[model samples]
Target: MARWKIKNVSVSGVAMAVPKNVVKTAELGLLSQEESDVFDNTVGIKSRHIAPDSMCASDMCQAAAEKLLEELGWERDSIDVLLFESVTGDYRTPPTSCVLQDRLGLSENCFSMDIPMGCCGCMYAITVAGNLLTSGNVKRALLLIGDTALRMGSMKDKSRVPLFGDCGTAVALEYDETAHDIIVDFHTYGKGYEALMTPHGGFRHPATPESFEYEDFGNGIVRAPIHTLINGMNVFSFAISRPPKSIEKFLADYNINRDTDIDYFLIHQANKMIVDRIVKKLKFPQEKVPYNLEEFGNLGGASIPSLMVTRIADQLRTKETTLLMSSFGLGLSWGTMCLKTKPMVISEIVFL
Candidate 1:
């Protein structure tokens, strides 16, 4: 296997638009005790970025991609490939990538597609771009991922109300001979499919009025029974076990176990608890882990790259730093990559 280097990896654009209104956990006091407890404890989310009534995943993604292209000063013709990775796509038929390409005014020569991974999407997309760049077929690739599932229901369902937020992130990858080394490893375990899933609205179980009806969970808070059933314990257990295992496997593959050998660790910002668990279990240094969940909640597929753009890219001082990034969730999938790179400028686009 030839080692592919990620040269000139820059986040050309980053923009996030939230619902006009913001809901806080404290505001959920009107709900029953069990409801409030689940919202506050398991979710551990104080607030999340809910999209406006009119916005969908593609709308936010296009807005972010436009800003990224503007910042990079590159025309649509320069991009050879466009990948939109998201669990909540704009439509079921025509892939969301097609809609995004047309919306962004990319040339018809550009190849566009969608990756259906949920939270691990950003990492998976980056891995694909890295391979394409290394394969010599494409010089520049645009990767975008986001989700707007938070708008699927009212704020009454405490189980999900605080667990999701909406945001889009774009990354520009270019081929550079002098760029840093990049290595990626992806893994999946499908046995736990029922553990965490949005069971309705897919080919397996098409959406029906029955799926939308309310069901009592022995509490005053009646929720759409099959909406997004996330067995918190199962999800957490899988996350805690898999992420560190992959990270360890990566380190062992490279024949090193020292903490200082790695510069930064960007784990998927699923929740503060998962972040803490991974760091503790791996015994990774505190500074190595970069977390922004408290501010952004969970941006689903966009979480990892968005953190890199917002937090990591700006603070990098030299080009030799070794960074480790991993994302896990939905599909019960996870991916880890070890990248060595030089500092590069990332443009920040203001989301109005």
Candidate 2:
């Protein structure tokens, strides 16, 4: 695990965009009534916004960036950096950031790049952008992070389909001399990478005949190597273990009082079970923790910002809110951070 304190950077605004299509678990037809009820009550997913085949992660992100830039009254030309973070990109090549730069009308000198990450992408991307800005080399940045997890999963895979949603979120950041410092702690477990992965279609295992073969895992879980596959037991175990420990250590190491210093705990919306466990272990009041999983399902890297836009936009828009954010998933990695956000522009949820 590693931690860093980034200074002179502040969150300016946040915005989120989701597909117009809504998939309610009860209507998915993949599960029986009894099963659906159990899933709703346990996993806590009621519906998920799934993007159509025609819309990619980049499109949603572009919409979000447009709205955010307009709301923040930020000039496109002033953006010194643009970070596109997500596992899903517009294409396998040409890097999605290049496309976004052209689409968003960023200046030719803008330092744009892509970070292929899952749940922890937002924090990681923010940390990277903060570094770029701290040197005064980059003045402003647009951090676009989200994923269409369902687009990568088999429609027939009940285990994954109902728990994943499509969302794109944009966060504006700028270098400010008076801004409070941002503390970030990041950790990774490479040995547990297989806990959550899309087994094929990478340079690693390149496409093989077997990659296309779909196997029924029984009980309605069916998928191929080309689709996202999650080892439930492995992920659940890791989620309930590592994240809480990291959060506690971050608070203690930074001399932060989780109960008082933090105004909100924006935890990753993995699932009710995983989230509930972590909150319980940390002994934080349920009211301090906000969630969006019930309506948007799990949005990978977009989870944290999506929560801000959907659940606590009012608070964030009204006053400075100290936040303790924690995220864990995909690479079997987790991150925890403490930051303060002044009353900022948090736009209404955009449905595309």
Candidate 3:
């Protein structure tokens, strides 16, 4: 079997949008006087952008795609495939990709669909798009990821509300047989479905008035009656352990060590603390970990790509850089991809 190679990968364009109002951790009263005393003992957040009442995940995604198309000078009909990734959608039926396709005026023959994943979404979507391009089935593909999970009634719960922010990201991938990029691995475990999920609004339990009533779990905070319930501690522990092990497994297969090896670590922006713990355990340089959670908070599936477009693209030079990109969260799902590419400067867009 012949191995796939990335001919050329350029983030042709990128854009992002946040809610009109900025919410700071201090305003949420998340820390006590004693908890706030220590210098490093912080609530792990400064501020995050929340979407306006009228904006949905799809709307934010559309804005990003529009900007990318303009910057790349891509005609609407030139898009061969559109992949939409998000855990939050406008509806359960009719994938959001269809809505984007129509809004963008893509050709009728274009292949468009949606992938519902949490934090790991962008990595997974890129892997899938790369495969389709390498198979000679498509010439160019667009990957859009955005989420309004924060707007879900469940996010109103104090614990989650502070951790999530609404945002969208867009990346354009063109077919390139000469490119040296490879998706090393991808995997998921659904057994932990109940451990983190919206308990009352899917096939198992349709939304009902009774289901929306708050019940005390003795945690002092009232759990949302209709929102997704995530066991935060459980999710955090699972995330910190999995990605490092997965990266180690990939390195062993390739027979490479960390020191004089990988150039960058573009892990998910799930949480500042989670990223901090992984950096320490993996012994990765603190500077290599690209963290945007402090300003953008958690954009769910959009986190990694948003960081790439906003921060990573602008800093590339002409050398083969090794990047270990990983994402883990909701669905208890996670994945990591190793990318090797020559540095190319990405043009920055003035985000609104």
Candidate of highest TM-score: 2
lDDT of 2 at 249: 82
Candidate 3 TM-score to native:
0.90
Tell me which residue pairs clash in candidate 2.
none
**lDDT values of the candidates?**
0.73, 0.92, 0.72
Maximum-lDDT candidate: 2
Candidate 3: which pairs clash?
Answer: 6-179, 7-178, 7-179, 19-50, 19-51, 154-227
TM-score winner between candidates 1 and 3: 3
Instruction: Candidate 3: list runs displaced more than 4 Å.
Output: 1-13, 29-43, 153-156, 317-320, 342-352
Of 1 and 2, the candidate ahead on TM-score is 2
lDDT of 2 by residue, 1-352 (tens): 4788899999999999999999889898899989999999999999999898899999899999999999999999999999999899989998899999999999999998999879998999999999889867778999999888887888889888899999999999999988999999999999999989998999999989999899999989999999988888899999999889988888888788877888999999999999999999999978999978999999999999998998899999999999999999878789998899889999988899
lDDT digits (tens) for residues 157-186 of candidate 3: 556777778887787787766666575466
Tens digit per residue, CA lDDT, model 1, 199-222: 777778888888888776653345
Query: What is the full ranking by TM-score, best candidate first?
Result: 2, 3, 1
Candidate 3, 139: how far from true, in Å? 0.7
- In model 3, which range of ten residues has the least summed lDDT? 34-43
